[model samples]
Structure formats: C-alpha cells, structure tokens
Target chain A: MTTIIVIYGLLAVCLVASLIKSRQKTKKAFLVAGKALLKMGPSLLAIIGIVGLTLGILTPETIEKLVGAEAGFIATVVAAVIGAITLIPSLIAFPLAGSLMRSGATVMTMSVFITTLVMVGVVTAPMEIKALGKKFTLLRNGLGLVAAFAIAGIMGVLL
Target chain B: MIKTLKKFAIIIILSLVFIAMAIWLPDIAKRSSIVAWDYFKEMIIIMPPVFILMGLMEAWVPKDKIQKWLGNRSGIKGMAISFALGTLPTGPLYVAFPMASSLLKSGARVSNMIIFLGSWAALKIPQLIVEIKFLGIEFTSLRFILTIIALVLVGKLMEFLLRRKPDKEYVLPGEGN
Candidate 1:
C-alpha cells in the first residue's frame, strides 16, 4: 500500500541522513526505539487480541444487523456505546456505516457511531494508561465521550 | 522483574480469555485469531519506522522546540501544528501514544497534545479519502468539519480540567519518555 511505501521511503531517507550526520546518535535512537518497543510489547499483544475479538464477533455484517434493528434515541445511544467500546479499523468501519445508512439507520446513529468509534478507546485504555498516565487517559477519553455525543447530536439535528 | 510481571498481567488475562473462547466458541476463537494475525502483520510492518521516527525525535528535537511550537502560549499555531503532525500517514492510534508521550515530556501543552491524539485517531487524510469514497463527499466533509470543531473544544476542555489542578503534571514514562 501507499502508506507502507511512503513510511519506508521516509524512514530510509531519515536513517541515511541520521547515520551520515552522527552515527552514534543514530545508534542511540535505535537503542531508545528498542527499549520503548520492548516496554510496549505486552500491552501491544493484549490490544491486538482485543481487536481480534472485537472484529471476529462484531463483523460489519453483524454491526449492520445490530444498528439497523434499532430505531430512535435508544438506537443512537446503543450505536454510541458500541462505537465507544469497539476499535474497528476505519477501512472496515466506514463502509459498514455507509451501508447501515443506506439500509435505514438514522443519520444521528451513523454519525455517532463513526465519531465515537474514532474518538473513544475503551479496549485500548490499558495501553493508553501505560503511555499517558491514568488521569490524562481518563480525562481525554471521558471528555471525548462527551464531545462525541455533542457532535453526534448536532450532526443529527443538522444533517 | 515485578514491574515487568505487572506489565504482562493484562496480556496473560487476554490470552486466557482467548483460550476460553477457543474452548467454548471455537468459530469465534478462530475468527479472532485470524483477525489478530492480520493486525499483527500490519502492526509490525508499519510500526518500526514510526518508533524510529519517535526515537529520532526524542534524540534530536529539543524540549524548547516542542514547547515553543506546541506549548500553551503558541495558541492557534500550536494547535494547527499538532493537528497537521497528527494527520500524517502514520500507522494507527496506538503508534501515536508513545510519540504523544514523548511530546508531552518534551513540553507540548495538554491542549495541543489532546488535539494531536484526537486527530491522529480520527482524521488522517488517507482515511478521509476512504471515508469520502464509501460515505459520500457530503458525509465525509461534514464529519471532517464537525470533528475539527469538536477536537478544538475537547482540547480546550481537557486543558482547563487537567491543568487547573496543578498536581496533574503528566509524569513521563520513566523520565522525558
């Protein structure tokens, strides 16, 4: 994919530049990268497992089924809750949301679903807590939940 | 060793859950493993360079530079920079967490950091194209506009709440991250 190519290209260029400018500093950067990667290994594994479970069970077809079956405010709330918790890759999620829209899920529900899906990360909270600290993790995600609802409500009303 | 053991606790728990799922719900378990394997490939592929970039940043970029660019007084400029940096074709949300931690240690403001993390999670340019493709221009554009506005609000709100208390100094993960 383009993402892979661009990142590797950039990395290659940067690595060459860093090595040319200061081999020792470049070595230290690799050291730091290794340390950080090691520190994160366990949590990363945990997150991948959670993502797998989420996707395995809550496939796009299943999401469409669940969101489409409900209607009104309750449906929006349900959608928001699901979105807040699940970390579906946007590649899979948008098409799923689009299809749900075509099938009769309300605009409010779809918008909230997509918004919360991006903003909130209940499943990844442990990794977040590890990286950002408990309070920062709590406040960012908690406030994000509020903002997601507000965006969804306003979008619901407008479009 | 205790700290390392503590770190693995959640992984162990999740692995146990996976095992339980495998026993009771073999189909879902198989599906989950497949999904996990797929993501694992993606993560290893895209994550190294990302961490290298962060490592390079941590080693090369000075704290004053980060602070001046993304610190509180930098205001709208700082916010804009944070959002722009985040919208880069980075791997995923988790990849941003370590960099955000580094930026915080390097003295980036909470508000800008919030915006950075939020946009990284939600609003990558490539992801937006995908969104527009599937969801339509109207839907994509509107969501984009709204997400920006909401992120700005979220940034300000988090800054107000977290910074007001003073003791909430985000401890960098083991010093300057």
Candidate 2:
C-alpha cells in the first residue's frame, strides 16, 4: 500500500517535472518505458507463473513440515535450496520462519532460508538475465548463495 | 514475432502445467491461480511507474553525471549513494533490474550497482521491521551487519571478475544504438 503510493507519487512528480522541462523528452521517456516493458513481458509472465506454482505447492505448513522433518546440515541445505527457488513474499515468509523456529528448526536453517530467499532468484532468472545479462545474473546469484550460507553459519554460532 | 513467441515458450508450457494441475490437482491449481493473480495485479500496478522512472532517468540523467556519482573512482561516496538509493525504495528486486541496467549503461561501476541491487533486495527498511518482529532484534541486527559485509565482498569480487573479462552486452528490444 505505502509502496504503491510512494512509487506513484514519485512518478507523478518526476513526470510533471520532466513535462515542464520539455514535452519531447517526456514523450521519449514514455517511449523508452513502453519498449522496456514490452520487451520484458514474456519473462515477467513466466516468473509470475513460477512463483504461483512454487508458493502454491510449498505452503507455509508444507514448508514447516519439510524443514522441520529434517535436522543438521541437511536441513539447512534444504531450507536454502527451497529459499533459492521460491520467491515467497516476505510478509508470509517471516511468519513462516517464526513458526518453523518454534517447531525446532535451527537458526542456521531459518537464517539461510530468509537470506537466500532475498538474495537468490532462480525463478526470476529469465527476467534478470534479460535485464542484466546472463553472466551478471549467474554471478550475482551464485555469490549470493555462498554469502547466504556464510551468514547462516555465523548466525547459527552467535544466535 | 517468432522471436517473441520463442521467448514466451515458458509461459505456454506453464499454462499447460496449470491446466494439468486443474484436472488432477484442483486444490493446488486453485491456490496457484489465486496467488499468481495477486502477484500479477501487483506487478501491473508497480511496474509501469518503475519503468517510467527508469526512462526518466535514462532521458534526463547524463552519462557523465552517473559515472562521476557511481563510477569506479567515485569510491566510498559512490557506494554510499548506491546504498542510499537502494534502501530508500520499497519494491521487489525485479523493479531494480531495469534501473540497474540503465545505470550500468551510463557508466556506473559494477561494484556500486551490486551494492545497489544487494541493498534493494536484502536491506529494505520495511523488510527489516518485519524481520525484527518475527525473528527478534538480536537476530535481525546480526543478519543486517553480516549482510552488509558480505555484500561489499561480493560486489568487489564481481567488479574484479567482470573487469578481467567483460560479458556479452544485452541490447534492449526496439532499441538501436
């Protein structure tokens, strides 16, 4: 809700400022935006479908069951892998993490899940590759997974 | 047109999968469709303004200015600016991709842009509040500190690796250089 308002508000302000400066440039901005949006159409749709499928299949209960049933390093690996592939909205994900923690999931597993969930985007890789190129996407995500594990290991020790 | 259709092959396959799920797993299908529809609506509402903002940036912000502000020699200042720009916005990571692309074209360093994208994904303000809520202050603070350190390391590594050998540049659709 706030995100929408802030974005639209910023857009409205920027659009007006650009229009006041030069109608031609403002029109060009619109053209660029439209072209980029059109170019991204397929990848965006694919991501939405994939997110739906992943989240639909891995409900919070299902996730709890999966992560809870496992223990030790294997559980952390499972949590991280699931987090990497699924793009669950943080709103649902944090609470799910809380519940998982209560259900005996380790800090390492929960932290790994949350960290990878934010940093990695296997499902959205097509869109990312389209926007940022294949190499950039792969390197960023690959490094992100490594960092997630490191962070999780530290959190496990400290917390 | 054919190229466009080829790009959409994944979507077509996904639709078939959805149809199959609807036949054999109606409950999952129903849930999936509802979740997808919600996300679709969010995307429709959020993406236009984001793209428009990126377009405005592309049109208005000069390349040299971007370079000076976020370029390699910009140093610590550039990283700070990138972090500020990233953390201020509240959106999914996808929304940052186009903006990052535009900035990169304008000569922003890969390291700085990595910081931008990293903070955009992991260090959001609202996201922190939620994390603190469910996960506790100690846990949230620890992750935040660790994430910053990790992001800087990762960003510098990417910069080094990419500079050693540049990757294929991607041209936007309908764009001609």
Candidate 3:
C-alpha cells in the first residue's frame, strides 16, 4: 500500500512538472474544455443517473453467492448485460470489485464487472448520441459490451 | 429559481424512485448499498490522483500532437498506436473522457479516441496487479487478453460506423463553441 502511494506520488509530481513546463505552450481551450463541460453538465448528470440505477440493481453478494467459483464467468455475463444499460467511472468500479472480492467474489466477476463498467454504457446513450451522434456511440458501446463478455469468458477459460 | 426548481424536481423524482425500490424491492437497495460502499472506499483513495493525472494530461499534452500521432489520416497504424497508448496505466473511464474529447477536437480520429478511452478503462496495469493478487496470475492474464481483443474489435467497429456518416456536431474539447 505504501509502495503504491509512493509510486502514485511520484507520478503526480511528474505530471505536475510536465504541466508546469508546458503551461505556456498549451492551449487554454484544451485544459478547460473551453468551459463547455458546464453546458454538458446535464448530460453528465443523466449518465450518472443511469450508472446509479444499474449499481443499485446489481449487488455483489448476489453475484458471489449465486456464481461462486464461476463468479468471474457469471460476472462477465451480468456485467455485459448491465453494462449495456449502465455507465460508471472505473475508479468506482475497481473498488467495488475489490470490496466484492474481500467478501469472496471471484476474479472473473470483478474482471467482467470492471470491463463492462468502462466499456458498455447504456445510460450514457442519450448523451453519447447527442455528443458523438447516434450511430457512432451505439456501435462503440455495443462492441464494448461484446468485448467485455468475451474478455471475461476467455479469462475464465484460460486463467 | 426555475433552474433550481428543475434540479429539485429531478432529484425528487430520483428519490421517489429509490424510495419505491426500497419499499417494493428492499433487498436491492440494501444489497446495492453494501456493494457500492466497498467499491466507493478504494475509489476515494485512487480517484483523486487519477483526476489529477487527467488534469495534468489536459494541462500538458498538445491537441495537435495527439492529432498528429493518431488523427484520421493516420489510418490503421494510428489505430494500433492509439490502442497501445490507451493501455497505459490510468484511472477510471470518466476521467479519461475529457482528455479524449480534447484529442478528438484536435483532429484525433473519433475511432481511435474511442478505442483509446475504452482500452484505458479496461486495460490498466496497476489495477491488473490488484486483480492478479486477488484472482491469481492465470485469471489476470486471461482477462488482459480478452480485454485487449475486445478493445481492438470495438475500435474497428467504431471506425466502420464513423465512416458510414460521421456527425459534424461533435464538439471537440478545445473547440467547444
């Protein structure tokens, strides 16, 4: 844990130094999203709403007890299905998986959950559509869901 | 006042839904809370640094450079590089998106950007260590291989879609008007 902290700290320092050195050369538009994120806040909120709903519906205990040793495989399926309708940050997903593991959840479960959490985002559909346009967002996320499940399944098989 | 009211209305609707779920499917609410908190804690520790890293990337990397490296003109080679770059150690998906949006605006192909963002979230190195520790090396290796394939495939699919009829309204990060 200490080592992790130290490594992260060094990373932070490096990033900051890089930022400082390049501050003058960097475009303000790039750094601040040219203040458009605020306008996009509502879309972001909607995405959050979807994520919360999915998280609320799926429980780690339910996944663990039900899936057991095959938890990883089961998790991939559940995550892919859920991910098809949800959107959440990876930071939140990882720890959620960690917590689940602490309580006897399988790697397959965590792996699937994390991958889906990132890749498959149904909740963000509207916002994604609005931003990147409909076809692009849907195709990307759809592919992502398939990938999440495949990855989980393959991991289960090989690992 | 109207905006505030709208916000409040949204919150109320959400709360009512939660209340309904709690009342009817009480187990769901209870279980979700139990799961959410466990994940939430580690997130608290890791997220700040991740956010900072993202901010730094935003603050440092030039959009043009990103474009030059992985723009639409860069083709398949650009896609491969984007995939590898996206696999770099990083944080959650949300934090990465803003940076990605910036890249897109600077001429980075949407396909490559999407691939990078997707892979960034799915294929983290440090998180992989944690996964290995908990799940064993075999599982970790499998997950990695699967995720990589998925990310690449997804990227290709996204490219195909973009080619069909790309949207002009996508407001890139720096070019948000």
Candidate 4:
C-alpha cells in the first residue's frame, strides 16, 4: 500500500544516506545504525504504535471462530508449548498470523501463536546454544514457552 | 571496502528475492497489505528512538558494569538481576543478542546471559503494555509471573549443564572468530 511504500522508501533513503556518509562503506554506517538503534527511543515508540495496531485489528470474535471454543483453547496452550522449541523471524510469523487471521483464526490462537513464535524459538536452538552455551539456551527457551502459554490462557480468560 | 562489497551483494540479492516473490506471488501482496503497512509504519516511527537508546547504552554502560552484575560468581542474585533487567522494554531479539554477547565476554555466566536475552524477547515492557490494553491486567500479570519463573528455572538448568563440562570452543564476543 501507500503507507508501506512510503515507509520503505524513507528507510531506503536513510540507509543510503548513512552509507554515503560513511564513504560508501555500507557496513560501517549500517552497523552504526544497527547498534545505535538498539537503544533509540523512536524504535520503542514505533513498537508501541505497532502493538496498538495489532491489538486494534484483533477482535475477540476472531478468536472464537478461528480455533473454535474448546479446540481453540487447547490450540492456544499447544501452540505456546510448541513455540518454546521453535524459532522463526518475526517477518514470517507476523505474515503467517495475519493470513490465518484473515482466514478466520481466533484472536486467542493468534495471540498464543505470536507469543510463541518469538519467545520459544526451537528452530534457533542450535544457534542460540552455540552462541550462549547449550544448557542456558535450553532453559531460557523452556521458560519462555511456559510463559507464552500462561499469557495466552490468562488472556483468554480475561478477555 | 571488501566488507562493503559483500554487504552490497547481500543487499542486492535480498532485494531481488523480495521483488521476485512480490511479483510471482500475488497472494503475498494481497495478504500482507494492511499488516505489512501497519508494521512498516510502526517500524519507521519507532526506529529513531530505538537507535537513540542504543547509542546511549553504548555511550554510558561500561563493559565492567555488565560483567560485575552477571559475573560467574554472582550466583542466584546475579541470575535474578539479569532476568529483571532483561524484562525491561526493549527492541527485537537481534538487538539483545549483541549486548548479551558483550556480557558473556565480560565474565558474565553463560546461563545468566541466556536468561537475560530470553527474557528480553519474552518479557518486554512495551509488549506488556500492548497485552494489557488488549487482554487486561490479570492476564498480563499472570503471564509475567509465569514467564519470570520459566526464565529463572531455565537459567538454573543451564548453569547445571555448563558446570558438567564447560565448552571452551564456544566463541564469546570480542574473542574473535
């Protein structure tokens, strides 16, 4: 859409400017932004806005229809449990969740799915273990999975 | 210069693949329309502040402080602090990894660092606000409790495993590849 294009365009410009400023050494500029951006306030603000949009778009009715009542509840927990061991980038998870939502997936299911998608990351296990050591990675992810499920279940009950 | 070339090549390839998918898969375009727009907009708005924060962290937080906080000998207190700190609102997982890596290099226990990074993704403050707005307070509170417990347990488990036989081959940041 127009919004997407504009945003990407702006990002491209910023990236290009940064690259040029660093004397065409793309990595230097990109890395600087990449590292510096981690602590930047705008990034947090944008995250807030995105979270708002996601919440606004997701309706409770959408939750009931996608997963069904009983099955949906079960699915929520299952997804969380499974998510702990699986890992994929947010780019994939967001689209997949959106597609599912459009196709009539429940909000609860989507919530659980999204939570697990980032939190559990079983797929990234080997890489994480390698980088941080095996035992620590496993334990952290394991805890994340449980938290994802708990969050989903509690949300389901409250909302 | 070589790194620049490699980066350029990677970027070009990635862009091409993206374009190819966009053209070849019409469904992707249709499906991702609203969500993608929303995500893009969100990213643009938030990126500046996030980058600023990253700069601040780089400028202010010293390597020694991170080490002392999560050092190997710190025990349970260290893990608890790491988890608490990780729960703070932050950026994507990728952003947290480098900081965690730095901690690892500075004498932080691998288990504690892992817990910190894991919590960074799972228990972010901004994410919590979103959950509260959409889901309600009770739900968010319970989730937080559960996530904290899980992170702590995992951290302990990792410690036990590492002690059995530490892997010296694993690369910590700044150790060089």
Candidate 5:
C-alpha cells in the first residue's frame, strides 16, 4: 500500500540524514527503537489476536445484518457500538459503509458507523494504554465515542 | 520466568481460546487465524520503521524545540502543525501512538497531541479520498467539517482535565536509557 511505501521512504530518508549528520545518534536511535519494540511485543501480539477475532466474527455480511435489522434510534446506537468495537481498516470500512447506505441503512446509521469507526478504537486500547497510559487512552476514547454520536446526529440531520 | 509469563498471560489465554475454537468451531477458528495472520503480516512490515522513526525523533529532535512548536504556548500554530502531521499518509492509529508518546516525553501539549492523533485517525488525505469515493463529496465534506470541530473540542476538554490531574504513570518500559 501507499502508506507502507511512504513510511519506508520516510524512514530511509531520515535514517540517511541522521547517519550523515551523526552516526552515533543514529545508532542510539536504533537502540531506542529496539528497546521499545521489545517492550511492546506482547501487547502487539494481543492486538493482532483481537483484531483477527473482531473481523472474523463481524464480517461485512454480519455487520450488515446487525445494522440493517434495526432502524431509527436503535439502529444508530447499534451501528455506533459496532463501529467502536471493531477495528476495520479504512479501505474495507468506507466501501462497506457505502454499500450499507445503498442497501437502505439510514444515513444516520452509516454516519454513526463511519464516525465511530474512525474515531474510536476499543480493540487497540491495550496497546494504546501501554504507550500513552490508561488515563489518556480512556479519556480520548471516551470523548471520541461521545463526539462520534454528536457528529453522526448532526450529519444525519443535515444530510 | 513467572513475571515474564504473567506479562504474556493475555497472549497465552488468547492462544488457548484459538485452540478451543479449532476443536469445537473449526470454521471460525480457521477464519480467525487467517485474519490474524494477515494483520500480523501488516504489523510486522509497518512496526519497525514506525519505531525507528519514533527513536529518530527522540534522539535528534531537541526537547525545547518540540516544546516550543507543540507545547502549551504553541496556540494556533501548534494546532496547524499537529493537523498537518496527522494528515500525512501514515499507516494506522497504532503507529501514531509511539510517535505521540515520544512527543509527549519531549514536552508537547496534551491538546496538540490529541489533535495530532485525532486527525491521524479521522482526517488523513488518503482516507478522505476514499471517503469521497465511497460516501460522496457532500457527505465526506460535511463529516470532515464536523469531525474537525468535534476533535478540537475534545482535545481542549482533555487538556483541561489532564492539567488538573496529570497521569503519574505515563512512563514506558526502559526509561532512563
């Protein structure tokens, strides 16, 4: 993907710059990276497992059924909760939202799904807490969930 | 050994669950492993460079510089920089976490980092293009505006609350290295 390429390119450029400027500092940077990577290894594996479970169980068809079965306020809430829980990649999530919209899912529900999908990240919470601490993770996600609903409500009303 | 096992308890439990599913629910287990393997591949590819970038920032960028650019006094300029950095074509939200952690250690404001994280997750350019393609321009644009507004408010609120009771356990492993 473009993202992977961009990151590799950025890393190559930055690494070269750092090496040319100060090989000692570049070496230190690698040390820091290695240590952090080692520290995060367990959490990363857990995250992978969770992502797999979430996506496998809540495939697009299943998600469609869950969101489409309900309407009005209930559907919107279910959509938001599902969005918050799952960590669907944007590539899959956006297109899924589009199809769901076409298939008679309400605009409010789709908007809620998209907003929560992007803004929240329940599955990534362990890794996030490890890096940023529990308070930061909790507050950011808590606020994000609230904001997602608000944004979805406004979008639903406006569009 | 016990400490290490405890640290890895979650993974151990997950592995057991996978095994259980394989026996009782073979189909779901196969599907789950496939999905997990796919993501594990992606993570393996992406994580090294991301951590390297974070390390490079830590070593090369001076703390005062980060503080001046993204600290409390950074104001609108800080927000702009955070927004621009966030909108870059980074891979995922998890990648941003370590980088944001580095920035926090270097004295960036909580609110600015929130903006950075929020934009990275919600308002990246590539993601917007995809949104427009699938969801239409009108819907994409409206959501964009609303998201931006909501993110700023959320960031400010978090900044205020954190300032009141700063998290004492923000340190990561291998600090003082």
Candidate 6:
C-alpha cells in the first residue's frame, strides 16, 4: 500500500540522515527501537490473536446483517456496541454503513456505528494499555464511547 | 519471571483459548488463523520502519522541542501539527500507540495526542475519500466537522484530568520505558 511505501521511504531517509549525522545516535535509535519492540512483543501477539478471534466470530456478513436488521434507538446502541468491538477496515465499513442507512437504518445508528468504530477499541484495549498505560487506555476509550453517542445523537437530530 | 508472565497473562490465556478452539473447531480455527496471519503479515511488514522512526524520533527530537511544539502552551498550533502528523500515511491506530507513547514521554501534551489519534483514526485524507464515496459528501462532511470538534473537547478533558492527577499511576512499572 501507499502507506507502507511512504513509511519505508521516510525511514530510509531518516535512517540515512541519522547515520550521517552521528553513528552513535543512530545506534542508540536502533537500540531504543529494539527495546520497544521487545517490550511490545507479548501484547502484540495478544492483539493479533484477539483480532483473529473477533474477525472469525464476527464476519462482515454478520456485521452487515446485524446492523441492517435493527433500527431506532435500540438498533443504534447495538450498532455502537458492535462497532466498538470490531476492527473492520474502513473500505468495508463505509459501504456497509451507507447501505444500512439507505435501507432505512436511522442516521443515529449509522453515525454511532461509525463514530465508535473509529474511536473506541474494546478488542484492542489490551495492546493499547500495554502501549499507553492503563488510565490513558481507560479514559480515552471511555470518553470516546461517551462522545460517540453524543455525536450520533446530535447528528440524528440535525440530519 | 512471574511478573513477566503476569504481564503477558491475557495473551497467554487467549492463545491457550485459541488453541483449544483450533482443536475443537478446525474450520473456525483455520479461518481465524488466516485472518490473524494477514494481520501478522501487515504488522511485521509495517512495524520495523515504524519503530525505527519512533526510535529516531525519541533519539533526535529533543524533549524541549516536543514540548514547545506540542505541549500545553503550544495552543492551536500544537493541535494542528498533531492532527496533520497523525493523518499522514500511518497504517492504523495501533501503530500510533507507540508513537504517541514516545510523544508523551518526550513532553507532548495529552490533548494534542488525543487529537492526533482521533484524526488518524477518523479523519485521514484517504479515509475521507472512501467516506465520501460510500457515505455521501453530506454525511462525510458532517461527521468530519463533528469529529474534529469532539476531538478537541476530548483532548482538553483528557489533558485536564491527566494533568490533575500526577499521583495516579500513569504507566506500569516497567512499561513506560
């Protein structure tokens, strides 16, 4: 993907620049990277495993069906909760959301699903904690869940 | 040793659970492993350069510079910079985690990080195009505006709470490193 290419290019440039400027600093950078990667290994494995399980259990069809089958406030909540749980790629999610909306899903339902889908990550919480600490993970996701609903409500009223 | 296992307890348990699932339900296991493998490949391919970048950032970008650029006093400029950097070619929210962590350790503001991660997740350029194509211009635009506002509010609130509570354990014993 373009993202990968850009990152590699950036890395190459930065690495070369760092190397030219100071081999000692560059070595320190790699050491820091190695330490961080080693630190993250377990949590990373945990996240991948969790992602696998979640994707397996909740296929795209299942999400589409579940979101499409419901409506109104309750449907919105279900959609939001499901959205918080799953890590669907954006391409797949947006189209599904659009169709669900066209099929009579409320503006609230789709908006909440979209908001929480991007903001909250229940499945990724463990890894998040490993990286950003416990309070941060809790506060960010907790506030994110609250804000997702708020945004969804306002959007529902306005649009 | 025990502490390390404790650190990895959830993952260990989950892996065991996954193995059991594999034994009892081969089909689901196969499907899940394929999905996991894809993610693993993505992670492996994407991670080295990212961590290296983070390392370079940590090593080179001085603490005061981070503070001046993204710290509390940096104001709207900080927010703009964080959001801009975040919406770049980064792959996922998870990838942003370590970067954000390093930023925090280097003295970046919590509020800016919230903005950074928020925009990265919800408001990237490529993502916006997909959103516009699939969800319509109106829907996408409205969500974009709303998300930006919400991000600022969330960021401010988090910065306040996190700053207010210095006594609280912010990071795990060895995890902050």
lDDT values for all models: 0.84, 0.90, 0.60, 0.55, 0.89, 0.87
Question: Candidate 6 on B93-124: residue-level lDDT in tens?
Answer: 88999999899888788889999999999999
Candidate 4 per-residue lDDT, tens place, B37-75, comes to: 565565676455444333334433576676667776677
Residue runs of model 1 more than 4 Å from their true location after superposition: B1-3, B166-169, B172-177
Name the candidate, 1 or 4, with the larger TM-score value: 1
lDDT of 3 by residue, A79-127 (tens): 4565455554444445556666666655556666767776766665655
Off by over 4 Å in 5: B171-177
Q: Comparing candidate 1 with candidate 5, which one achieves the higher TM-score?
A: 5
Supply candidate 5's per-residue lDDT for B108: 88
Give residue A123's lDDT in candidate 1 (0 to 100).
Answer: 83
DockQ of each: 0.71, 0.83, 0.29, 0.15, 0.84, 0.75
> Model 2 clash pairs?
none
Instruction: Rank candidates by TM-score, best first.
Output: 2, 5, 6, 1, 3, 4
True contacts kept of each: 0.71, 0.79, 0.29, 0.18, 0.84, 0.72
Go through the candidates in order and give the clash count of each.
0, 0, 5, 32, 0, 0
Taking all chains together, the TM-score of candidate 2 against the true structure is 0.96
Candidate 5, residue A48: the lDDT equals 96
* TM of each candidate vs. truth: 0.93, 0.96, 0.66, 0.54, 0.96, 0.95
Assess candidate 1 and give its lDDT: 0.84
Candidate 6 or 5, higher TM-score: 5
Query: Candidate 6: what lDDT?
Result: 0.87
Instruction: Name the runs in model 2 displaced over 4 angstroms.
Output: B170-177
Candidate 3 vs candidate 6: the DockQ winner is: 6
**Cα lDDT for residue A106, candidate 2:** 95
Q: Put down candidate 2 lDDT per residue, A1-159, tens digits, no spaces.
A: 999999999999999999999999999999999999999989999999999999889888888888984668888999999999999888888888987888899999999999999999999899999899998899999999999999999999999
The C-alpha stretches of model 6 lying farther than 4 A from their native spots are B171-177
- How close is candidate 4 at the interface, in terms of C-alpha RMSD after superposing the true interface residues? 10.2
